[model samples]
Target: MKKPVIALLILPFLFFVSSCNRGKAADEVNGNEKKQTKQLDTIVKKTALTIDTVDYNKRMVAMSNNDTTGRWPVKAPYPLPGALLPYNRIIAYYGNLYSTRMGILGELPRNQMIKKLQGEIAKWQVADPTVKTIPALHYIAVTAQGAPGKDNKHRMRMPFKQIDTILSWAKPINALVFLDIQVGHSTVKAEVAELEKYLSLPNVHLGIDPEFSMKNGERPGSKIGHFTAADINDAIDILANIVRKNKLTPKVLVVHRFTQGMVKKYKEIKTVPEVQIVMDMDGFGDKVLKKDSYRSYIYREPVQFTGFKLFYKNDIRKNWVMYTPAELMKFTPKPVYIQYQ
Candidate 1:
């Protein structure tokens, strides 16, 4: 009886000790989690501060044309002011694998496409030897055609396999990849979110074409679409988050525009250190009309950066030669981004 009494007395002590130990372990884990969370918060705050340091107020002032000759300086401060742009200049081939008429990006066999890209890079190097030219494969990951899919999204998201395959195709040649989104009837925010995983990669960038955004329920290709500055901001904000989390170089955002209606509220599109916005003039015409379009639209607007597009079939329709590297250099601030499609 005495032995049983002693055992019973010891049981409570053992239970108390076990409970104390379990509590200690739980406390340790919670403490560690809090510490990590605090550290990440600090890092994110620092990133936001870095963006705030860039005086957007001075952006317009800096892009001013102090030069009277109307000549775009070859060494102009470009891509963005007060920010480190990834490349001295970017020249990309745009298209999708399914369409030959779209552009040179995916018209040929995989091996042949890589070879042609290499050739174009070599030629651009000869054309503008002063600036570093980056070769990019602009994959139309999503196509917005006239018909709405069964989902009725009015947009078709490229299968992950296709995007991955093209990204793989760019690897052997060491070219950067750009995933362009037409959005069809979808919203830019939703479309960009779907691509967040790929956009987080260091080598991949993004392009949003307001031309097919279809802000309304109107069918794509029936009328030109529009993207407000708010829409652009949403995309930029998403990219900025990826940059901060991954600690990456600034991501480039190519905004395709040739008409005022395509991109509304231009001034409201703000910039952050983690992303660069390039307002590309995407129009096909003769050299004279193209120049006028560039001057009247892109050059006149003064966005964070400027881009020019050349059409193999359309640019040469009326003129003997497309605007060469030297001729494009004549704008007040030269276009640092050029696309051939």
Candidate 2:
């Protein structure tokens, strides 16, 4: 009877000890999780502050032409965590893979073209040592065609393989890739949806050429085409959704505009933090003409950012010279994105 009593007492003691150990283990795990979460929070805050420092706003004011008007710097919403505009200068090479006549991206062999791009990047780096220069391959994924294909869109879509090739090249260099759309008769919404898989990537961006939008069913190249603010908004909305869905950094959207009609109702274009919009001066001419075009369009109608395009052949045809980075930097709100064709 005494033995049985002792066993019952011991059993209760063992059970109590086991319960305490389990509780202790749970507490330890919870403590570890809390510590890890706190560390992660600290790192994220530090990164955000580093990326969006006070200097970004200061630089914007400096770029603005000392205007009392609030429109110069465009009081758009601050971008989400990983925005790049006004922070780094993008030096891009533009072209389509099918035709070498389009631009330098396809004009030369891959190695030679990349070398040439690196040289240009060096020049810009030397010109503006403060801002880092990032190289980009701006591929024309949708090309406007003279003859309407079976789809009757008046545009040809490059196969996925070519885009894959561009991505493959970009990986080795850590370069950004921009898939440009010339939407011939197709809408921006439709064309952009097709490239969703690629654009979901963090480094991939977007460019829309109003010069070939061709909204009136007219043949592309017959006359300069136009895109309304609504058309541009379609792209912005899509990009914003992609960024949010994939938990990616903000994506850059380049809008090519050399003339007033190329982009219409610029004021109505909504500015979202998820996408950075650059109104690129898409003309090729002497320094005087190029500057005039930029001031007339980009400067007067301020967007979130600005871009300037340089044509290797057309820009120098008139003056036999291209505008140096130093000279181009003198413009009010200097271009943060520079494209060479």
Give all candidates' CA lDDT scores: 0.75, 0.87
Best by lDDT: 2
Candidate 2 lDDT, 92-210, residue by residue in tens = 99998888999999998999999999999999999888788999999999999889899999999999999999998888888999999999999999999999999999999999999
What TM-score should be assigned to candidate 2?
Answer: 0.85
Local accuracy of candidate 1 as per-residue lDDT tens digits, 32-151: 556655655555443443422234324333333354544322122222222434335778889988789888876778777777767766776776575677778888888897888897
Query: What is the Cα-based TM-score of model 1?
Result: 0.76
Candidate 1 local lDDT, residue 55: 45
Per-residue error at 65 for model 2, in Å?
5.8
Cα RMSD (angstroms) for every candidate in the order listed: 14.0, 11.7
Q: What is the RMSD of candidate 2?
A: 11.7
Clash counts for all predictions: 2, 0
